[model samples]
Target: MELRDYLRILHRNWILILALTVLGGAGAYGYSLLQTPTYEASTQLYVSVRSESSGVSELAQGTNFARQAVVSFVDVVDSALVLDRVIDDLNLNESAQQLAKTIDASSPTNSVIISIKASNPNAEMAASIANSVGTNFANVVVNQLEKPDGNAASLVKVETIEPALVPTSPAAPHTAVNIVLGIILGLGLGLGFAVLRSILDTRIHSLHDIEAATDSPVLGGIALDPDAKKRPLIVHADPRNPRAESFRSLRTNLQFIDVDGASRSFVVSSAGPGEGKSTTTANLAIALAETGARVALVDGDLRLPRVADYMGIEGGVGLTDVLIGRAELVDVLQPWGTGRLFVLPSGRTPPNPSELLGSQAMQRTLEALAEAFDYVLVDAPPLLLVTDAAVVSRFTSGVLMVAASGTTKKPQLTAAVEKLNAIGSRLFGVIVTMLPAKGPDSYGYGAYSYSVQEESVSPSGRGERRARRSKTEET
Candidate 1:
């Protein structure tokens, strides 16, 4: 995917990311509060070798020997030998081996100085341990390691350079650092989860998914309405509503479908059931009739017809009666809403809907309706569930695939397109229904003024009023 795709994923899951980050920081702070606070103290020791006869050469050799010995003495500072003396002097409860775990020793390069650090729960105890360890280490190196004979004085000396002081604050359980690290860890995990979900999820969320899956242009997006089932005929019920306006916009886009103006009939179908194909067809027909166009809305689904129910018309005898010679086409077609729009309901549930719809009699009926009406819209069944839509498409100009946003999967949409392609049916365009009104994947409709003017004035009257206003300004 591109960078914008990743950015969109991040925008969509921003709440989850923020919640995880805050949780991580809070957890780190709580953990820090429960941990024991440790205080650290450090002391430095200076090592020097005694010179003979105050000669420059002897002094240089002694200094070099001391620098080399100090490096090794740093390691011995944290050993059991030095820690044992430190424990004895300070009356520590732990053994030398255990006490050594809290001690650290190091020396700078080419330097005769050794640094020792010790940590404990008590600040005073930590300082005492550091000081005691330095003192005992110096004594051991002078009397035992560097002493030449039993009666002679030691030739090397170790002096305390910087004594350890009691620390005012804890050295471990860094609250601020821990919280920052926790937040960073949480942010990484959140982004990983968001990206993975975006990659794995196949649901159609926006026009981008439709464009990616097929080459057909999206006619328009219908805003989701919770009470859509109650008022299926939105264009007639609420003409000024935004969702109703969307159908009008879809009606405007539909006009440009057949540039040559050869065929006006279209089959509306979806991948599976409950994708708003019937409602879209019914509302679109009403929207077209608003322009004073003669529209014929046919309930083509013989299996389970819904246009009749949604249009509030009688469905006892309609398309099936005409196809079986029981009724004429002009007799079953019912006018709706005192407009030029007509509704042809599915007469009865037939066992062989495919065979009946694909018959030449159904073709002749659609051809006669197309000749009479300005626009003929047939609401067919789902393409995947049956071949009725594909068969109907052969008689119409093209098929309009209506897919539900966030409900129809990409694979399902592709398979539906494939079914149309297999029968060489023209996929005119796509219409996405149930689109959200907000967020990154929302379908945005431009604001339109619906308020009617309270008064009317002609152009000559307005010009005379402007002339009078100019004369008054001159006075």
Candidate 2:
């Protein structure tokens, strides 16, 4: 819709654009190789119509007659009779009708000069065709139009001004011109395709899309955790990993998003499942704990919980037991290693999750947790599937909606945001998941803090250090 939008489309579909350009250029080049070159030659004929007689009346009549004769001869230049003679004189293999196509006769404006042009594969043949057509027409005009009724009439004549020369080069099959035309055509097609695809695609592929859809600022774009399954304790084992760093960056963004207000408790949820909502909650809690803040990771989705599995703890006798008055919160709560992080897993799947979250006791439990911890990160079900997240958000401080970059549609994201706003949930911001590596030029700042770090080292050593840094930086 704007310049930046077009640029984003081009960036996203560069492969398609490159493929189309190469295909069009290759097709044009191959066609140029197959085309036969055609050469052209032209010869001029001048009409001589003099008005010279003894008396004034005779001179006027002679002038009129000469003009009429010249017009008549001009028509006869390409007649079947002229072509038949020209074809035979040139020893052409084609018939008179076919040879007529290669020959053309034209009279210049307000002048008695007629030009004969011919085209052929061979330069010499083209020159010969031009001369032969002119010669045959000259002979026909002198023999038939000048002499009338088998008696000598007042003469009108035409003569060749310049002899037709053999052309040195072809006039067609321009390889350079065709290649340039192909490039223009290819670029137009590629841009058209990019625009069409951008219009058709309704998925959110960038941080801009999330901001536009929800009217919320983008906190950070987190890369997909590549070794997400390799180890469950990503925050503790690989705290400096890029994936972990993203969570810490997100934590920092949250601190400054609206520092004037105090909103510590957050509900982490998405439009649908498998958008990394649970992992994001666990990581955020760990990141916050690393800052020496007491953080509680709550498995609020009693319907289906994953925080316990990710934290490598037993799921029995946790959140459900604490909610149903069967167990104490302190007894079921597990400490996450030696960090100031605590987890409350969903003891078992419950059929009355919405009722439990909406009850007054749930509100009291949230108040108690808020007093005990510095931050409470509740991992809840997807917004579209259930009202658990929305119901829980009424008691929490704010809501942080998670959305997959390419998987979440605009309409779905909008609906999810509207649902939260409809229930009076304070939306903090959106976190964009699964973005490709942001190149320095791509960001338009001409400087990434990471790329600038390489400038401190020598060029020869930069390559090896850059690789090692990338491996260390990437998770």
Q: Which model scores highest in lDDT?
A: 1
Off by over 4 Å in 2: 53-76, 91-93, 145-147, 229-233, 257-263, 439-475
- Per-residue alpha-carbon lDDT of candidate 1 for residues 198-278, written as tens digits (9 for 90 to 100): 889999988889998899999999988999999999889987677888899899999877644554999999999999999
How close is each model in CA RMSD to the real structure? 6.1, 5.9
- RMSD score of candidate 2 (Å): 5.9
lDDT of 2 at 193: 95
Q: lDDT of each structure?
A: 0.90, 0.79
The list of candidate 1 runs beyond 4 A from truth reads 259-261, 449-475
For every model shown, the clashing-pair count is 0, 0
TM-score of every candidate relative to the true structure: 0.91, 0.83
| Candidate 2 structure quality by residue, lDDT tens digits, 216-278 | 887776775567777655667776556667777888887775532343788899998878788
Question: Which candidate number maximizes TM-score?
Answer: 1
The Cα RMSD of model 1 versus the native structure comes to: 6.1
